[model samples]
Structure formats: C-alpha cells, structure tokens
Target: MGHHRAHVSQGHERGGGQTHEEHSGSHGHGGHDGHRGHDGHAEVFRRLFWVSLVLAVPVVALSPMFADLLGYTVPRFPGASWVPPVLGSVVYAYGGRPFLTGAVQEARARKPGMMLLVALAITVAFAASWATTLGLTATLDFWWELALLVVIMLLGHWLEMRALGAASGALDALAALLPDTAERLTDEGSEQVPLDALRADDVVLVRAGGRVPADGVVVDGSAHVDESMISGESRPLRRAAGDRVVGGTVATDSTLRVRVTAVGSDTALAGIQKLVADAQASGSRAQALADRAAAFLFWFALVAGVLTFGVWAALGDMPDAVERTVTVLVIACPHALGLAIPLVIAISTERAARAGVLVKSRLALERMRTVDTVLFDKTGTLTSGRLTLVGRAAVAGLDDDELLALAAAVEADSEHPVARAVVAAHAGDTPAATDFRSLPGRGVRAVVGGREVHVGGPALLAELGLEVPSELGEAVTHGQQNAASVLHVVRDGAVVGVLAVADAVRPESRAAVDALHAHGVRVAMVTGDAQHVAQAVAHELGIDEVFAEVLPADKDAKVVELRERGRRVAMAGDGVNDAPALTRADVGIAIGAGTDVAIESAGVVLASDDPRGVVSVIVLSKASYRKMWQNLVWAAGYNLIAVPLAAGVLAWAGFVLSPAVGAVMMSASTVVVALNAQLLRRVDLDPGTVTGRAADSPSR
Candidate 1:
C-alpha cells in the first residue's frame, strides 16, 4: 500500500499536476506517507549494499576454493567452526536489516510481505549453523549462500531504486525550472531579489532569454516568447505592451518591462506543478490492488516457509529441513514481485515522455487501455482554437479577391482577434486608415481611401437601413448552416459582399477520430460552443455523439455519465476550465498548451497542438499493457515451476534438480521478464497509422 502511494505521489508531482483540484484529488485518493516509506526503503537499501558487499568477502575467503587455490592445509582453531556462524549473523543483522524492519512494520499493521520471507530465510540459516557449532549435530556452512542471497537482493533493490529515482527526478527538475529570483525595477535601476519577496503591482524588468519570474502584464517593451513549457504549444508568442506573460515561460530574443500581477505559489506554473505532484502522490484503485497483492504474497510465502520447516523437521532431518526452509525463504523473496509492476510503470512512463506525453497520474495510463469512448473538447482538441476564413460570397459586381482586400482594409485598424486574422489573410502591408468605428458585436465602419466602408455581421447592414438581395440572404444562411460567422461588407450603406469565418476543424483531427473508430472506439465531442457550432464540427468528423455548450462545472458529469453507461471514456481537452472533467475520465489527455489546471488535470500532454497525440497514447497504452501482462505471466509461471523443481518434486521420477541448476533457472526467468518488458520500446505507434484510414475519409 505504501509502495503504491509512494509511486503515485512521485508520478503525479513529477508528471506535472500542481493545482488545487489535483492536490485535493490526490489527498482524497491517498496520503503522502507512502512516499515517506519509500524514502526509508531506499536508505535501508544503500546501507545494505555496503554491508552485503563486505560480508561477501568473508564468505569467499571461508569457501573451500580458498584452501584449494592456495595449495595449503590450515589448522582449525578451537571452535573456529563458529566463525562462519558469527559472520552469518552479522550479515543478517546488517545486510538484511531492512527486511527485518519491514517485516516488523508489516506485522504491526496486521499485514506481511516479501520482507518476512527474506528475514525468515536468513534467520533460519544462521540459527541452524549456530546450533551445529554448539555440538548438537554435524555442522554445515550455509553462511556463503546467505551472504550471496542478501547481496543479490541488495543489488536488485538498488537497481529498482535507481529506476524509480530516474522516473521521478525528471518531474522535480521541471518544477525546479521556475526561477527563484526576479529583477525588480525601481526609480534608479533594477535589483535582483527573491521571487517570493515580489508583490503584486511591483514593476519588473525581464531581459532577453530570461524566464518570466512571476505572472505579470507587460507595460513598456515587446518581445517574442517561447511558452511551450506552460502552454504545450511550440509556437513563439509575440508579447507586446499590455499583453500578459505567464511565469516560467522563456523570453526569446526580446526584453520586456512588466508589472507583476501574481507572485509566489499563486503563479500559474506553480499551481500546475503542485497539482501534478498531488495527483501523482494520491492513491487510486490500481494502487490499492497492487498493495493487496503484495500483502497477500507476503503472508502466503511466510506461512508456506514456516510450515515447510515444521513439516521437514518433524521427519528428523534438521539440516535438510533447514535447507528447505532457507530455499523457501530465498525463492519466495518479494524483490521480483515488488519490482514487477513498478518497472512496467516506469518504462512506460519514460516512453510516453519521449513521445511528448507527460503523464500526471499512474491510473490514467492503465485505464487508457480499456477506454471505449473518447470525449473531445471541441475548441482546442478538435478544432484549431483559432477562427479561419472558410468561404466567400460575391457581391453583384465584385470578385472574391477584390471583396477580401476591401474588407481587410476596413477592419485593419481593429484590435479584435477576428479582425487581426482578416487583415493577416490579405497577405500584404497596407497604409493606415483615417476613420474607424468598432461596432460592439458587429463589424467596424471606416473610411478606406475616402470610400465609405463597413465590415460586420449581417445585422450591421440591416441596422444601417440597407437592403440585400435574396441571393445574398441565401448565401448568409448557407454560411451559418456550415458553422461559419457571416461578415457582411457594406459600402455606401448597402450590402456588397460577405466573408464567412469559423473555428475550423484541425487538418488531422477528423482523421484521428476516424482512426479511433476503426479501432472500435466511439468518438464524442464535448464543447462550450453553441449547439450549431458543436453539431457542425461533429457532423464533419462523423462523431458518434455531441455534448454542446456545457459549462466547466458539468464537464465531469459527462464523463461519469458515459462510465455509468458502461463506456470507458477518455476525455481530451485544453483550458483551465476542463480540469475537473479531465480528472474524472478514464484517461485525461490535454491538448496543445494552457494553464496549470489543463496540464495537471490530464494524464497525458501532447506537446504539439494536434489530436493525433491522443491516438498515440491509446495505442501505446494498449501495447505497454500487453507487454506487462506477458512479463507478469512469465515471471509468475517460472517461479511456479522452479519452486517445485527446487524442492525435489521430480527426484523420484529420476529428474532431480540441483540447487545450482534451480538458481540458474530463476536467474534466467528474471532476465526473460526484463527483456520482455524492454520489448515495449520497439512497438510502432506511427503517426500516420494514428491519423486515419483512407477508406474512412475519402474526401481527405
């Protein structure tokens, strides 16, 4: 249980969940003490490594090989046979101390684990040899085997710890990237000070290539910034005076003087980091299962080993009984069992990272394998988030390009996003306009080269007492039906032409949906947009369902509803509002970039603003899960077969297995499991395969 909690905490915080919701969710799922125990385990493992390595030297020196190789016969000291027994006890106490400690802790909690088996094995071996030295019977030197087994366990644990540290350390590194200091501007010059000492409304000066130390609004300079870390989109954003720059974004090739608006943990990036840490630390259903399994194995092995000693000793062969007991203890050690799931989790996690998916929760990847229904947030997930021109309507006398140029000139002076897009589409620099009036919900009215010009929605034409032909009205209706925003261009108080713009579907999104469908996954679109807009996008993608105009509060409800209907849903979204829904789904995938909530709520983050990444995660999860299952089967199966063989089950059948042979077989099984898990790296999740099937979308 502690192991699962430890892994969860490490995974989330490291993955990038650092929000209030993520923190609360993690706490609700599980506490942070599991991680504390992991720390304890690591400390014990290090101490054991040195202790075991030391004991190994004496074990070799006491071996028969020592005397044979030296070609000398040595006199035995009085009661010198006790030397091995004393040294074996020292090894058990130092090299095997953690197991003993863990066994005691587990026993106190009314649970037991692999540590109990290890402790019992080493304890029994030492006790048996010690008794023989006391003149009770013929002495056997099991000190070598005991020392070697502990050394092997120490090495295994060290490797396991290294893997865990590597997986978790990356996340901590990301969180650490936020600079602790900022340059605060005063009347004379700027001074370097701790970011936490900064206050809202304080002016700050950021130089070229410096991260924004806190959330602030630019006031005196302009620059291009790479916000990829915070937003997940690789595009370089141009920040001018009055634009907001988030903390933790790299200032690329520009100097900016900004007024701080948020500081300390209130910053967006800090919140994201906190949320990720909390989500990872929290316990989930998957972790509960792992804990239960470990507890069960610990108890089963302990009882079996004890019963084995009792049964064999009652038959009057104490040394044979001790060997069997020690074998049970060594063979049933939970090292493999403890590592199996965590290793799979760690490898898969790193693989996802390389693929540009930052996993915030462990259960997210596991649950992705079972997701049958996918819900996408339309704005940033399915559509390009930015509106684009889709169609043009001709006036009675004007061509398409002529109408576009006139409209672009009229709207050029406007600061609205749509206006900027229209001007950008004209593809050339133009002279400044003389007169311009921005009508609220409508377009703008201006004078371009002294010719009265108007660019706005169709309602602007009616408000200006203009009359339009039926043909033009039909065009407007057609545009609206296709989910376009109809912009009427009126010159001299009459409607002359129209431009249709809408939040267009991404080029690869429809294909991604189709690919999912081909893989037997149902696609659904969930959006805050109006019914007509959402419906048009869904129809275009051939989606199975549409949930439109839903507020952020209700996002999670949709996921829960789908699950209640027996559909395992994967929700992909962007924006701070989608955090709850992302956390609620079977798998939470964040698209492009956004606030900390967006990154922390989701299990996977797509570095690129493309829907195809979701497909990559789905296919990868399936592949990784399959590999884990295969490894688990082989590891468990090998242990099952080898345990019986080592106990001499086949001796009467004239196929007796020696201890050395059994050890070789066990080592081979570990190698096989490790190799099988490594094979996941070779799985092909080609972007083309995830995009679409040709047969599904012939129009493309």
Candidate 2:
C-alpha cells in the first residue's frame, strides 16, 4: 500500500478529489472519452485475446526450445517449424496491434505505460525468434514466448477493460429506467408520442404500470407512484391531484393525468444521470496515481531490461542476454497495477447507484469512510416532511368531533402546516367563517360559527394569558415531550381544545441511525425546533447529540464549529436551508435525491430519502479502498518477485522464471485484481438490512 498511500496523500493535498480532465490527461489510456472508450477496448481485447491464444497453441507446441524445456516432443515435419514462425508473426501483427499502437501513442506523449512494456517484450521476442529460425543468433529462439506474451497481455487487458466499464453499465441501467414512449393528452384525446416531442405543460396520461412521462404535478386522478428508480423507495407513494411526480417513476395502481412542468434536461432523471456521469468521468484519485505508476513501471522495466542485457552480454552471451531482457520486460505487464484502483472505484459507484446513493463527487466517496460524526437536519430528514394529526383533546362542554370541527373551521383559511394538518384531520363539515387574520408566531385568529376563535402553539396560549386546563394539560404535555406540534384552540380568548400535529419519524430513520452507530459514527440532530422537541426526537432515535432551535442561517456555523473541533463531519439534510452547512461539511449528504437543492448542495445524493444511504456510502468507500489496497499489493509484489526471477536472479537456485511463466503470472495477477474488485458488487447495502428490524410507522 506504499504507492497506494502516496496516491491518497496527493489527493488530500488536492482537496481529496480530482477533475475529469486530469484523469484523462494523466491516464492517457489511448482513448479517454470516459467508459465509451473502455467499452471499445474491452471488445477489442476480448477478440484479440481469444484469437491470439488459439494461434499461440501451435507456436508454443511446435517450438523445439519449448519441447526441450517442457520435455515434450513434436512430430518431425517440414512445415512444423514454419508453423511457429508463420503463426507467431500473425499473432504479433494482429493481437499486438493494440499494444503496439498504444505504445506509439505513449511514446509520442513522452509518457510510457503497460502498453509500452508489453510491446517492447513482444517486439524483442518476435525479432529474436525469426533470427534464430534463420540461424542468425544462438539461444534467441523464443517464438513460443512471443506468441504467449501477446495472448496473455491481451487477456489481462480484456479483463481489466471489462471491469473499467462497470460505470457505463450503471449509466445504461439509469437510462433504461425510462420508457420509450408516453401517452400525451390532447384536444383530440390521448396519443402516444416520443418523450422528445413532449413539452412543458403538456398533459400526459399515465396508465397503471406505466412510467411517468415527465416531471409534473398530477392534475387529475390518483395513483400510487413507484419512484424506486429515482427516490429508492421500494413502496409506491400515493399520488393525488396537486402532488408532484418525477419522470421515470411508475404509476402502479391507477391512472393519472399529469401536467408536465419539466422535460428533457430539466427532468429529475436527466439531472440524476448528469450527476452520475460527472462523477464517473472524474475517476478516483488512486486511479490517476496508478496511471502515473504504470508510466513509472514502463521506465522501470525498460531500464532493468537494458541492465539485464548489458550484464549478461558482458559475461559473453549476447543471445541469452537478449532473451533474458525480453523476459524481464514482458514480466512487467503492469495490468494489475493499472487496474488496482480504477476497477474498484468503478464497481463501487455502480453499487452505490443500485443502493440509491448517487456519488456526485469522488472526494465524497473518498472522505465518507473517514467521517466520525454525522449531523442530521431534523424536520424533513428524520421525520416525514409533512405534518400529520396525531392526537386531539377537548374541554368538558365539547366532544372530540365538535372540537376538531371548530379547530378545522378556524384553521381553514391558513396554509400553515399545522392548519393543513387540522383541516385534513377533520372528517365532518367545517362551519364557514370570515374575518380571518394572521398572528405570525402566535397563530391564526378567525371567526368560526360566528364566534372569534384562535389556534396556535403554546406561544399563542401565553399571548392570550391562558393556561391549559387539567382536562387537556396531560395531552399537551405528552405532545410537547414527543416534539409534536401542539395547537391550542380558543373561542373568544378562552381555551376550548387542542390538537397534536406531528411529523412522524420515518421507519427507515431508526435503522439508518442504528447502522451509522454500529459503524462507530456519532449521530447528531440539528433543527430549528425547540430544545425540548429536538431532544425528544433525538432520544427516540437514540442519537448521541442534539443542537436545537438552530436557525436556518446559522446551520453552517454548527458544521464549521464541529469540524474545528477535530471531528470529521458528514452533514445530511433536506438540502434547502442546509445547503451552506452541506457545503461546509467534509462530506455533504443530501437526503432527498432528486431535488434540485439536493443535487446542487451536496457531493453525495441519497436519491431516496432513506438515511441508510449514508451507511452505504461509508461501507462502499471502505470496501473499495480495501480492494484497491489488495490489488496494489498483489500487482506490486508480482512485479517485484517476477522481475528478479525473470532476470535470472534465481538461476543459481535453478528456480528462474521463464518468459512463459512470467506471461502466465501477469495474466493471473490481472484476473485476481478484477475478481477482487467485482466482489464489491456483492456488498449488501439495502436499508432494510441495516438494523435487521426497523420499526414500522403506523398509518394515520
């Protein structure tokens, strides 16, 4: 991990992240148009590998030197010797084209890498083998080695190339989430049309089991929208008139006519896709370092090959010296080293997307593993964003129904969350009233049933100098302790009833907090709610810290203060007022994924409102880093040992590595690295699995 650590250290100095331009320029991996080029390389190398391997079988078997080394005999035939020379040449020209051309590009750029090393080894072997077949030099007959080298290098690259395209697979999956066409509502009736033909304000008829054509508000009808592709919620959300629905989400149970507010790039699907593509293009800091390391390996192997030839020739064996040099150069494939980090980064991002965690920045993925504390914005993050009527109480003269109806009538004119909850809770007719007036923090004052009635929190009770009677005091205290928004109802300045409006905690919140805690992360809650309320919710969720009554403008100060205390903080919020704080934190985790604020304010978006995505990000970071380290150590170790052995360092012990053995080791190392990186996809990041038993929220 020495060189791997160097990569991370340099990344830290550069803000623990890198740009897409730097990744491409530094890698100079022939083609750098993100994964598009990688996919091309994968297909090319896969074909090259299989063809070269087939041709190598004969070239290897027909070689006298190979027969002698392996104690096997080939049938004496006139054309048998020609088989090696002819097939080997074809293998070099066809299979070696990619590496040879790639080496030329690197040479022109004055930056060499694995391609140059592989090219040099095969060129030397091809030249020497032909010469020996014509009796030009002794002991330079290595057609078998040349053929195998090309085949093995091709195989190594083929495997690495496939792994590098993992990000592309995720991108394609995202694109495939949308339907090919949509039903548009027109004056003549609904007609099928392409998404591109649709415009803003175009009404789309989404039938049961069809995806929403665009981001819009439901104008008519109701349905359960499954936004799992965008929001990561497995369950379909109920959608009704005036409710917003994102494009690409499914209308699961009923039909809905939606008024399109956004199309094309403005859709949430487009936004999420762009964020993902941007992150994938950047690559990981370690991948950039590996590219540099590959360049270094090329120079290292070249210098060592020259030294090996010089020493051996000085001992009076020019032909064997050239072969030994060829062995050393080819032994340094560098494929494993080249793949060590990038493949891990690619697979991690892919897995993150599947878990509803969109990693919009490599630095966020890199730093999440280091986070020791998480600051959560309370209201819309831990709790459902909307207020629901939870409990009600009444005075001796009125029944519960009458009290609720009176309160609803008074609150009908107000649009406050508390008022909405009260109006939504009332099942019977609410009496009409006029003389509606706003009291700001104190609550609303309106004429209900021709009597002046008031509704508000405890502040309104204090302003009116009214104490809660013993009949409703118990419920009021209970509501206050649970952080429920208690609204006091008054008639003609006298207390009449009370209602409890609560933002019920999401069922996923407890599991998320528990999982973070299990990972040794300290959970803290920050909100504009009062101390008592914040503390009550914090206690219920088992959070370790609580910062209550925090104004939206001061949220960032809390993040800055925590970071100044030597704690690595990750701020997860609703991405509204918490934008500044999110930008200030070491890692910004915007809880709501598809929201513009979430996408713009944070480095990481939870595409779903589930808090467990925080854990997923951390888990993926650590897992990816572990794979990077594993691959680096294996590749570095293989090069270290194989280079010396191939250079005949162990010849005195009769344990020297032949060129064929070196080629085998190179491909094996690459296979090992790719398999290890692929293992990341096996990581279970589902929020439901976080704590094993998340308590369910009772339906209202």
Candidate 3:
C-alpha cells in the first residue's frame, strides 16, 4: 500500500444552539475562494458584454466611416448624430471598467500586461472619437470601433473565467462528498447529528450507500467501501471490522458502525484538496519564463505604438496615424501569452490530483520529463515489509506441522514481527504457553504445555552452544544462501527444527519495473539489506543496478553517485531512512503508505501503495509539458505575425486592420490557448491499463 498521512481535527461544542463549524486549513491558492470568487467577476463581464453589444449597434449604424464603407448613406434624424458619441461613451466607462482597474493594479506593481495594453487602446480610441465629435480635428470617427472593442474584450474575459471555474470544480466535488448530517450511535439507539458535531471515538452508523461522515475505523458489521473519490481506485474494497475507512467514501452494500478517528480538516479529503490548491499556487520555471516574455511584450507594444504614430504622422495625416497606432496596441495585447502557461499548469495539476498523483513541487514535475533512471528502495516500497514463511525443515520424527506448531507456541506471546509471522502460519490452535520471556536482540522462550520451549535465530544457537542436527542443517544453509532469515527452534536444550522467513515481494513491483524499462528508463534498487537479499530481489525484477548493504544515512550518496554519472534520477521510497535519498534525487516519489518524513521530502506522493503510480507520474509529466510548448509556440507566433499587420505594414496592398478587427483576432488566440490546455484531460491515467504494453515487453 502507498503511504497515507493520518490527521485528526480538534473537536469543539457548538454555542447558542448553532451547528459546529468545520474548519479547513488556509490554502495558498485560497481554497474554494480562488474559484468561487471569480463567479462575480464572470457575471459582471457577461452582463457588460451583452449590454455593450446592444449599445454598439446604433453606434456602428450612425458612424460616417462605417456607412461610407458599406456604400450607404446615414438616415437623417433629430438625435441621430448624438447617438454614436453618447452610447460609445457609456460603453467605454461601463464595459471597460474591469480592464481599467486591472491595468492600474499591474501598473502599481510595475508590470504592465494584457490589461494595460487593452486600456491604452480603448482610452486612445475614446479620446480621438470625442476629438472628431467636437471638431478638434477632421479625423475619421472612432466611436463605432471603441464600442465594438469593449464588447469583444468583455466576452473574451467572461469565457476565460468560466473555463477557470470548470477546472476548479474538482474542489467543489471534493467538498460535496461529506454528508451534512451523521447518525451517531447513542444509548437509546442512533441519533442524527451535524457532521461537525462528530468527535473522535464517536460511533456512527454508516447505512448502505451512505457517505462516511468522517475518517474512522469499522467497529461493527462489514461492507464494501467505494473509495474511488479519495484513493482513485475504481473497485470497491471489502472493509471489515478494524479496517480504516476515510471520510467521503461510501459504504456500498452493508451498514457499518464506524468509530470516528478524524473529522473536518483532519480528514484525508481535506489534505488532498489542500495539495491541489498548493500545486496551483506554486510557481514554475516555465511560468516565470512566460511572465518575463509578457513583460517584454508589454513594453514592446507601448514603444511600437508610439513609433507607429510618429512615423505615420510625419509621413501622412493625423487621422490615419491615430487609427494605425490604436490597431498596433490592440493587436499586441499579449492576452494569449500571459495566460498560456498558467492555464496549462492549472488544468494539468487538477488532472493529476484527480488521478491521485499529488504534486508537491512544480519544479520536480517539470524535471520528470528528463528522468533517465528510477531508483526504488527495497523494503516497504517494492516489498510488502511483512515476513512470510518461505521454507521449513523437520527432524526425523517431527513432521512439518508439528515443528511449526511448536515454534508458534513458543512465539505466541512475543511482540516481534518474525514471531507474529510464525504464529500466523500455524494452522491449528496454539498450545497454551506460560512464563514467556523475551531475549532482547535474539528471540523468545516460553513453557508450552509444561515443556520448556525456545525459538531464536543464529545468535540463540551460538549462545546455547547447540548445533543444528544434520537433517535441519542443510535447510538452514540453503535458506541463508537464498537470503531468507532462518530461525532454529530448540526444545529442552536440543535443536528440533528450522523455519525460513523472508519479506515477500509485492505483485505490483515487477510490473512497475517493467513499465519503467518500456519507457526507456533504467531501474535500480537500493537497500540496507544483505547483499544476497538485495541481489535476489534485483534479479527477480530485472533491475539494471543494485546498491546493497548501504546504510540508511548513505542512501543519499548512492543517488549522488547516479547523478554524477549524468543520470537524471527519480527515487521512490517509504521510510525515514529513505528521506535523504528522496530529497537528493531529481524527482522523489513517496509511497502513500510511507512515513511522514519520507512524504515531506518527496516531490510527488502516490495515494495508492501500488508502484504503478510512478508510471502515471512520468506519463503526466510528458503530456503536460507537451501542452505547455504547444501554447507557447502558438501565442508567440501569433504576435509575430499580427503585430506587423496591425501597424499597417500591408497598407500598400490595400489591406489595413481596424482596431475592432484586431480585437477579434486577439480574443480568438486566447480562446485557442484555453482549448488546447483542456485537451490534457483526455490522456489516459488509469493505473490498471496504463502499463499494458510495458508488461508485454521483453525483460531487460
């Protein structure tokens, strides 16, 4: 299983009959506020867009230039001449307010962007149109162009906000998983109470098909729990008594009485939400590059607009100069460039979160694309970390069952992991043992049915100076050669039998290594286990490199050695000893079931204990980076071509762009970038099907 971080929220009583409030940690991205707050901004832009569109119709119809271009004459009316200027003024003030305010914010920060470019273009158009209306100069009227530009810009912003809202819907979906009320088990039966009223140790009844009110363990009954929302595992897992059930999961088929272990912000769902928010807020190298490019473009447009106006005015008339300059500024707004990277980052992070791949570092995610090697820690990461009986041998008269039972009876009261494995493997009821004694760093001793029995490893055998009989000696040698820990069982100071124990390899580890090879990434193993043990596992998984018998503190040095060979390495581990190596690697992936120290040091955390999640990380990294480049190339290329045309470069061929038409092209470019980022959602990330082709490849 992957590393899982457990958190518990503090409980408090409600005052004045009010329901207890659920408090979540403050996310850097402002949690739901970052998305919900945009609702008002989107609504304002939407309302202004429609209203501006309505007011622009008369302005376009009454403008002399528009009528002349269409080969028509304006109909004379009592108030027709005043309609264009009055409505154009209203559109500029009302519809363009957001852009005006945004420009001010950017200016105050000394980093002008798309908003400033837009504000400059419209302000010039507004001033020039009123200049013509008051007879200040005989220039072409710009009232119609100003009105249309505002409406188009407003429409574009509204669509952008809506797309952001859709991407952030993941947070809302997570929040909705918790039920408002819970059925608390009480003395008189079950009583309904608010979800926030649930405290740790409170037994709650989770009826069939009901959401688990909080993170807890099953106390009574059994059920299949659908944890897909929390763990991204599609199949419902059978959860019996003492099984942990996270809040927001559903008990599908049977009712369960669960003892609440955590509530509110302490739940796993809350942590996942916080991770998503943090990833979105984190800055990346690519984003910084995009920001720099946008800042440059802002100054470029400002200077180019000035140069275009000065050159045209010296060579021609002021009217043509104003029109060309306005077009230049409008077409070079950098709207697409500014949004290119941020949009891709937002969508990709949300997509990764939904797949149970939590990205703690944006830079590590970016680095995953170049990884050449994947180094996995052996214990608990690639293996189950639980000892299993692999081989057994018995003396002449003692059968295998008789030998195992004797060992189990002696170890029944010991708290060592190996002792538990022995007891678990025994089939029949264990004989009663009394006066149990634990030998520190050795094994255990107990009186089983009035016979003094002792179970220990090689140390115990040497201390007692009792040699293993030839019949069991061969088995002990074979077990040692195969990297299994053999325990010598002694009854009444005489060696009786031997049992071999080894940590079992997980079924997913082989597939995980094979998948990495399929992606052309070399796999390596690092472990503090003995050379024979580590090598045996490496050979089984087809690992290319092995670093065995390394101390926990020296694991990071192994990662450094790989890097010194010019290898871009990714490390996957699940222990406190793995923390240094995890941090030293190019990309550190912590198993969801790993320790907190390992998790904190990792750049990515896999929610499932399955090793296939490593493959998912690589796939997502490649896909997300591809989208980022596609957007950058498009945004930069659009400006390269559009900026010159808007400056009247093709006027000699009778093709000059008006400010209104320039605004349309700019908005279209922004829409294209947004749509391209959304395509990342279609990439297949399901761990089950993710490595199909890898499994069929020849072993390296």
10 residues in a row with least lDDT, candidate 2: 6-15
TM-scores, all candidates, are 0.75, 0.87, 0.81
For every candidate in turn, the CA RMSD to the true structure comes to 9.0, 7.9, 7.9
Candidate number with the higher lDDT (1 or 2): 2
| TM-score-better candidate, 2 vs 3 | 2
Decoy 1 TM-score against native:
0.75
Local distance difference test scores for all models: 0.65, 0.76, 0.75
Best by TM-score: 2
Residue pairs in collision within model 2: 593-607
Sort all candidates by lDDT, best to worst: 2, 3, 1
What would the per-residue lDDT of candidate 3 be over residues 1-700, giving only the tens digit for each residue? 2111000000000112100010011101222244564455467668988999999999989988777666799989999999999999999998888778767766786776666766776788888788889988665477877886787667656654454454345656866868899999999999999998999999999999999988888889999998766555666878876567888889999999999987877776666655655555565888877766766777888888898899889987777887788667767766676557766776677677777777777888999989999999887777766667878998888889988999998888865567767887897988888999887656678998788888877768778898989878789888766557788889889988898877767676888888899999999988777677777788878889999877778999999999999999999987366889989999998875411312568888776666778988899999989998999999878877887788888888998776656656776887888788889889777666677744223432
Give the candidate order by descending TM-score: 2, 3, 1
How well is each residue in 630-673 modelled by candidate 1, as lDDT tens digits? 76566555656655555545656976444434444555565566
Candidate 3 or 1, higher TM-score: 3
lDDT of candidate 2 over 406-503, digit per residue (tens):
88888898766567778888989888978998886577888976799988776677778999888888988898887777788899878988888777
The RMSD (Cα, Å) of candidate 2 is 7.9
